[model samples]
Target: MPVRHTDPPPAPSRAPSSVPETPARTRSQKVADSPSLMAIVAIAAVGVLLYTVFLFDFGHRGDWPAYLLVVVAESFIVVQALISLWTILSSGHDPRDYTFNEAQRALYGNQVEQTMAIGIGMRHAEMQLNDFPITVDVFITTYGEALADIRKTVEAAVAMDGAHTTYVLDDGKSAAVRDLARELGAEYVAREGNAHAKAGNVNHALSITTGDLFVILDADFVARPDFLHETVPFFADPTVAFVQTPQTYGNLRGLISRGAGYMQTVFYKFTQPGKNRFNAAFCVGTNVVFRRTAVMEIGGIWQESKSEDVWTSMKLHERGWRSIFIGTELAVGHTPETIETYTKQQLRWATGGFEILFRANPMGRGRALTLDQRLQYFGTATFYLVGIAPGLLLLVPPLQIYFGIAPISQDVPGLTWFFYYAGFYFMQIVVALFTIGSFRWETLLLATASFPIYVKAFANALLRRDQAWSVTGQKGVRNSPFTFIVPQVLAFVFLLATSVVGVWQAQLDRAFSLAVFWNILNTLVLGAFVVTALKESREIARASRELRALRRAGREPVGEHDEKVVTPVLPEPREERRAVAIKPVTPVPPPRPAIAATQAVAAVPRRHRAVAVRGPAPRPATRPTPLPPLRPAAPRPPAPVLPSQSGPPSISGPLPGLPIGGGPGRARRSAGGPRAAEEPEPRTAPVPVVPSPRRRSASGADLAAEVLSFSGDSFSGDAPARRRDRRSR
Candidate 1:
């Protein structure tokens, strides 16, 4: 049965919608998807050998204490490097294998001949998996995020191409969020208390809705329409628990957001995909889809830890459920736009890692994890110890300068030390370059300055303290970067004073001490951090001042907006402003025998929309909201959607917010609302301009005579204008 936008009703026997099948990948194509893995491995192999040679070189041992510190610090780095190398080696494995392809084909089998119906009023893309209808519920977990931010996310979530219900799980308890959800045709969900923060909010939603798979998006995330289509097929396998996609960021222009985003980019690009081969791919909270049964099997999202996402993944793994991480970016959202948000985010994540390390060891007995998984999870648990290394290393130069304690003995020549240092550390930098394409100075700076946060997180975890974030954060009241970097400032002051003292000592001895040089380097790194923080603080202050001025002037900044109460329904793929689908290069001739001639010819291909409004629509809402303002013009009655004899076939649907002026037919409408017709108007007939009689020609008939003859009255020589017959094929 063919779906038609025409007035006729659809057949009850036909399935509502379908997904197109993806062709099977050949062996060569599969290999090509991961072409760079082998080069990375080859380089990493050489790097490991060089690292081992330098690490075990005992001939250059200094004072035993200093040597011990150096050994411990360097060892932490090398271990992480090699573990990351292992993960990157496994990154070549593609999750979309033959099994996923077969499932997609079955899901794609629904519509024999179809037209995808989508627009503002009704968004539905119903499909089948394993011949069973499945409902997917999208949960957009939001706290006190801006209303504008929430609207953009909900709009995209509802617009995503799949059969799903979009719910704004507003733990913020804002009435504005509710109104925004209503305005956008999404259901609003609110709860009394956010006990477990994000996890608790989602768990409550899961209880109310019985969807087979639930997609969790942060309040800021705007999902691409195919977000579900890309991840849902993996659920075709009974054992797979969840599918994780990369948390890509669109707000990386800011200093903090850029650094944070790049840091995550590396992991998403390399670490997560590799974890898939071990079946240890963990969820990062957002941009992930989970099977309801799998989440419920683990007693809902784990509430015992702030890092509920990781703990939930662990519990599922212990229950022998597999996880998959697709490296593709399915959604783009905001990263930490300010240092305050960044600090809190890192602290939360680091705390979770420490909690896992101390509380739930993946390698512990009575576990179901594989050896590959145990090592990977164990590595994750111990990963933040690397952060501890930076704190310890920062103190080494001060110790050497003030107390004559050195990690490297005077026996090691400066030239020899340089070779050994470059072998391990430089090789690591090279690996970073190969993996992420380039080294990010912002990432490095942030990482170096971030040890203080990690150490605090460790202490918080060790002491069994809960990290709390202020929910009462006032807009434009963000704290300065100084609030988060007190420790870094102290370290900078201490390192600077030590460097001065070391320089004085070196002058007296008439020697250029390497310890002094190293101390100066550390001081500069800390100084750079302090300088950047101060600069950011100034920028924040300026922005706050401007905001205050705006408030004083009684004008608040506008955020995301929507169309009026009634518009022809259309959900377009992600673009700048909403737009009509691009027209076909050649016009579609007309509906053939396959399509009923009564149906209007569609201008675009089938696309994802949630509930496509077809057949008889209910009476549209009577609220007569005015359309967007336009320049004054003579009133012309809106064209009927039906085929017209005078023009080409009328456009099938309202031209969605097209670049050209949207006609009266494209009234902005909410989902489920039919466009209300305009009040009857008497259209004034257009008068054809008569070209004034040209200057009298010198020939037989003057121009005025010719014009008079061309009118309805026949001329002396005239026959009716001949119609050129179109040739029949």
Candidate 2:
């Protein structure tokens, strides 16, 4: 019998930085060779050829049924190809150019500038290494994490290059960490209350330690030998507050983990450098050095908030201190080795980020924060909201498959769609290529697959009444379908059912056949996702079991020793220097007030005061008093009478109230003539005066009449009795 050979177990996935060397594709070579473009061309060619064949066959057989099916298939392929092409084209960025030397140089320079400002500053301070030999306190925070992981980190901290004392603040209360700490000659600080989770643990450490500087590390991370050598000197600067180092991962044993590491590199090595360039690099909750004075000044590490690092940093910045981001990845940490943990971590981050946006925007709070600080704070908090975009995009294709409802109309001719959609598709490819490169494609696809889940998680977090921090379970294990399986299964079932219904409909009518193909394709894609999810689920379960067993065995904990390390205590307020004040000089007398020049002005006021006049002083007569005016002088010779028409003399009595022109029975006036006058009769009419209501005499009545006659309108020359009669009427 022939010997049978079995395949060896797969090697654990290595970190991207550590991937075994493949033949390197040079920049020029990659640009010249385009596999994506070739695939697109091939797809387009097949589509056109199939359409041509269908067109000819339709002409020959006159069997529109077969021809229609071919046309539909051909159309779908062409449209899909064109869409892909268009996306690649419209992305506007050239992936090939992104990897070019010049682009790399720019990105490198940005990173250097960022790292230099923060990392160099810290390192330079460290170089001034004080032989003060102060005892420093180290806090390693753990939550539902495996003992082995905790042990690795604690052991690494113990090996730190300084006279440092370590403390393991285990929220899980695992004896493993306590024992490991004991073995490593470090202190194990366990807390009964885990109210704020990691923050609570760290604060507990703070209460017990008397160190001048606190080095905080997450349980999953191990410190480097030079961690203290590179960071401690930064505290020498009285103004230098806290120092933060980039988080780096070592082994990436899976595709997800590898992708996450790559993202971190780009973020820390590239984006972080840029941020640091502007003094905006923020803390990542681990590998941070805090000044004891500054921490205490702001009430120590904040435990009330979900994200303690951000909350504490905000307070520190508000209190007029500085933070630095050391570009060097000085400490080694672990990525989520499986997809479930990876997703869980991302979800928790997203939820926490949203919490900050809703609750912690410091803009309107009237704090004395710089514009740069505000932007940095807001940018850090709102970064996770970007996940909503991909979540929305995922729903689009699924909806298109399930219902024949396209978000955009697909009724355009095949050729029109070919160029338009192909260009759009090409644009996206370009953008992806430029931004993430090929290494991240799988991660992007997985992210796409989990988009809906992420969206739901975010929405649920928002709606839930209680906002509590739930640490992602990082122990590598595979479990049953209960965690991530049920959703996948349900999605698969729905997708499968839709596909079957689509195929049945296709058989009945050729027009609906395209719908059937679309549904079937959706089903296949969903099925792929379901398989991947199950695999990840199993891995998580296995890791969980391993972690539980390690806990039961009770391995030694890191940071278990009780030795106390003394650090430089900050100076008391009385010992601090105070500003000196100078004595005030005596003032000279002010200039004397100026005196007025004239007493003559004062004499004028005295004269005016002495000349008070009585009311109504007698009026002065101008020389001659006028005699009574002569009478009207004989009516001034009767004014000439104008000629009148002779027909019944036009009955001209006071001209009735007619205008100067004549109508049927009226006389007309000519423009040139002047004439008709009447004489004034008397100054006053004879008075038939009755006795006044007040019983006054006739002389008084006469005086009243004289006054009335002098007044116009009422009685200019008439009797007072007539005026009185008119008033009565």
Candidate 3:
């Protein structure tokens, strides 16, 4: 007989559907497809037309109010741009005879001194470290994480070929990890209460473990085998308590990761070392080894805030403990895999670091930190505050484009612009070259894209609101619809509206045009962010739905799915016994030699059976070979099991008649056969069997079964009766 089978659902389409192009230019189309280049052209055309009209119709007005307005707006833009430039240029010290450019100076001028101090301090600290013996303790902290990923970190730490003790602080209290730690002969620590997140975890280890110095390693980090050997020798100075190495991620190659890492390298390797020459090396959160005594002297590591590292460093410095910045990359950790996670991490650090500045300015009050230390901490805190700068820039253009209000009044003398505005503008180019000239294009774009989000986040931080940390989700593929596209949409809309208004009002001039142009430029820069955000949101939503369905189907652990699952009320739980539906039979010749291949082929399509009881399912048998008691068939009168009544015909006879160790005929017989006979004589009624309402109370059993089935195909070979028996025994 010819066999038929349902084709498998077409694999989900990965290629995104193409967005339809805008047809002939409608009003909405013009708005949506508006480009920055187009905006610039439109604004320039309007400016020329307006100038010509003004000269002809209202030539040389007695007051020159419009002229004054243009001059005033330009003056303000020039001054603001210059001041910003000066801030960037003065922000870093040029210790190695390094030169600056305008953009670099504008970006970092204000931070130059602090960067220099830290660099000077780092150099001095390194000189002092030329002499102390150091033993390191590497602590890897973990919450609930995949065992494989955690194992990779553990292995890296354990492989460190030096006088270092490796400890895995399992926050999840996972026995598997503990066992693995034991196997690797590393210290295993599990805590049952508040360790208050990561800070508490590290502190708990500090109190218990005995190491000359402590090194914090995140669960996703991999320490070089020679990390301790290379870094420990630098702690020779009795005054030096710790040496912080840069946290690098060898595996991360995303544009965002590279951009952020480039900045870090500049700060830590170049700027920080210069600052260290003056005793101003500050503590970074991780990949740093701290002196046991120094930490203990400060009453153990501080857990007062989310940024415990900074808080602890403050107290340590107050007590005269010194820190140094080591330029080498000794340990590697996973960078934010997704933009969402990256942004979250940045926001947390920014907000928390700022809070430290507000609450504990080592240099501000009569605190113990020295001049250099205070400046270092202040610089660290100011990094976050800088996020507002771009937002301010963004607002400037919009204000000029929307309203003709110049932030700087035109009443000021024109020559002041030469010294203050001109000088600042020139310095900005210098600073940009010095700080981020290598990735000028990308950095500029990112800066522009980040403006809105940065503004919103900065405002949120000022309000002292809580922002939960989110991990970026990436699968070795750089793609996300929301983060990549939504910003573009918003930017397009803003640019189009502003451009049309500027043109209609005939108010386009150099100042007005520049404002409109910059805004449009910013929109393009942020386009990727919007698309990626949307895609991330959609993926999260889909995952949540799947989790909920699994929970409802009684195929997942209760609490595991509780976080994502949505449960609906049912009239009552039903005992649903459905036969395992096997896939269609594939013809094969009968042969003894092909038995092994046949078995393997058959295994691929075997259907695994599972029954969902209204309440709970019976527990599995403890003994391996013991069979469960047979459940008597229901005692109701025999009913007809015709082809249609049975739901569908199977080529094989009734499932009950098939052999427990059925052969190839079972496959052929089941292919589109007639339905079983549902009706039987009343005299031959089957025995009544009702499951006892009560069953195991544990909710995880069902989930555990499902997980096992999916993970290892454990249920594929069992018959329906055997599956029930296995569960009940």
Candidate 4:
């Protein structure tokens, strides 16, 4: 069972009013006292003493070599044990590691209030000074990973609800991967060359993208939608640079995978929380959110170190930037299954750690690394080098007995030496078990088994070989050849045979017999590690055959019971989404009393009028030119006078010298003056009617004179004159 961390003392800085301040609880009150724990510690101490005193022996005074061998082996154990004991005791005093389980959280009275306070901070950060939404970029780095595996992670990221964008930083530059990103509705960025592996890939991505806060996820790690919700609130503090969550590998299966996962659990649960107390908690490379400014300040994620995450964290801390490690498992991933993959993974970590120690020593003349931080970093950096002790200890006894060479010339007292050696070892285990909150024998065995690999890693790191990144064994497993274990196997066999022959010889003294037995135990331990490797390879081969058979039968491998393991297919790309602008609703003002049309017009400006007219201009005019004067008529022969029946008076000779329809009674005015009508002209021309022949035609002047006379007599506007003329005609 995982133990909850006791709440640390409240900070002097005021927590948000929303997060009610609470007094800290003592560790004893927080953790219920357990009798079983006390019992285990007592039993372990007794067992160590009894085993050392009775089962093992110090040789006679003549056997000086036996003493030397025991001292050499014990020296490494004592130093490491002392370091572990001190760390555990100090860490347990004020634990920062915790579980989020309900019962555990109840120990902190203000958890809910703290949660609300964080939520409020998130709201503030989300709304910038100008109130525009903050941009968050989620970058999933990939290099030729299976699309199906990465697609799940991408889909999860896209499903997150926030002002965030998800990009797949593909270093492989595969067209198929680009299509996959498009299909999943994620932006895909590919670099031409992998300059510095993952760190370089991320730096290149950082250059092109613009986001206020960025999240990093490995291609296989699927994030919870609420990852930002839980994490971003912590960044409300200006000092916080990044937030790291546990890399929970929930998909691990089989013994090897489970064992590897357990080791991770110990680190995330115990080791990381302890580091957080010193403000030395480093990024674990994935499922971490970093402030853009913080990353930029660190010179773009430290390209020099293979373990960029640690180096980045060290630099950031040195620069006074703070980091946070949340114990929640918000994202999950896979662990290496096969022995070869597992060893490679461990070696890579070991190599990177040593590289940091030598190339850029955190403990050396660094800027602002605190004393506690230096020790913490030193312990981590030198962990792989310590594996050398186990290898040397395993070889010590076999060589001592095989050749008559001894490093010591005299033996020491048995009970005193046993008390010193066994007591240190047992006390270390007790403190570790108590401090870590839980212990698993399998985890210890796994660490013990990896000693040979660590020995090789230490050598490699010293030689500065294998500095580049290699893919972890989470990929498909292969049948591991036993060639990798030949040295280990030889050591195991030599030790076992040496112990048996020494026992059979009967010339060996009690001290020599005890040495043989110790060698026997070392052989078994080494053999167990070899067996683990062999079994892992065999299991992978078996799983491969089973998978192939299932594939041939046109069925996917079942996950649980008869249920199928279905991989999510990428959704089709959606049409571009246009942002819908929303207009604000405002209250309508009440209308004033209606105004008259004239008043309304008066109130309006001329420019604002519906239609406005400019001033009218007068047009110029001129008198019509006088029509050409009517020409005088030409002389013509008079028409034959028609004999007239006498009614009023006889008219003849085409009514000469008068208008065509002018009344005979009307007076006419010559150009000189008005004249009275001339009534009785000579009427001797009243002869019989006869047709007159055609005579000389009238000139144009005569027609013109006739038209003018008609116009003057008929078209003239004198109504009475015209009526009288009609009556007479």
| Top-TM-score structure, candidate number | 1
Q: Count of backbone clashes for each model?
A: 19, 57, 92, 3
Question: What are the RMSDs of all candidates, in order?
Answer: 19.2, 39.3, 27.2, 38.4
- Which regions in candidate 3 have their CA more than 4 angstroms from the true location? 1-135, 408-437, 451-496, 503-512, 534-729
Candidate 4, superposed: residue stretches over 4 Å from native: 1-133, 404-410, 435-439, 474-483, 506-512, 539-575, 578-729
User: lDDT: which candidate is best?
Assistant: 1
> Local distance difference test, per candidate?
0.64, 0.49, 0.47, 0.55
lDDT tens digits by residue: candidate 3, 1-729: 000112211212222222111113222222223353234334333433443333333333223443454444344344333223222222233221111122212222233334344432111011112212223467877665556667777777765544355677655555566666666645666544533467766655553444456788777666665455445544444466677776666544555555445445445534455445555566667778876656654545565556667777777677666666655556666655455556666666666676676667655778886675666566666555455455445455556656665434445444643444444444444433433333345445454455445545555556766655332332222344355335435765676676666655555443444455656666555655555456666777787788789989989643211121111111122122222223434222121111233333333222211110121111111112211111123232222221211112221222222111111121111111111122211122223333323423335554344333333333444335444665786
lDDT of 1 by residue, 39-114 (tens): 7566766776676676577876777777788788778777887888888777767889887877666654443223
Cα distance off (Å), candidate 2, residue 518: 8.6
> Which of the predicted structures, 2 or 4, would earn the higher TM-score when compared with the native?
4
Name the TM-score of candidate 3: 0.54
Per-residue CA lDDT of model 4 for 1-729, tens digit only, reads 132222211223443443222225433223323444445545555545554453245443234554455555555454444344334332332322332222122322333444345443212122121112334678888775666778888887776534466778766665566666677767766544566788877765555444557899988888875577556555545566788887777545655566677776546655565566677778989999997666665456776656878888887887777778766556767666666667677877888788877777766884587887777777778766555566666656666667654433335565654565566566656645664455656566566566777777777777888655766533333656365566667777777798787676546454445456767777677677677777866776798888898899988653211221121111121232222113333222111122234543444332212111111110111111211111124322222221111111123322122110111122221211112233321112222222212212555554433333343443234536644654565
Off by over 4 Å in 2: 1-135, 362-369, 401-404, 409-438, 464-478, 495-526, 536-729
lDDT tens digits by residue: candidate 2, 180-271: 66676556555444556676566545543445567899887877655775566555444545788777676655665666665554355334
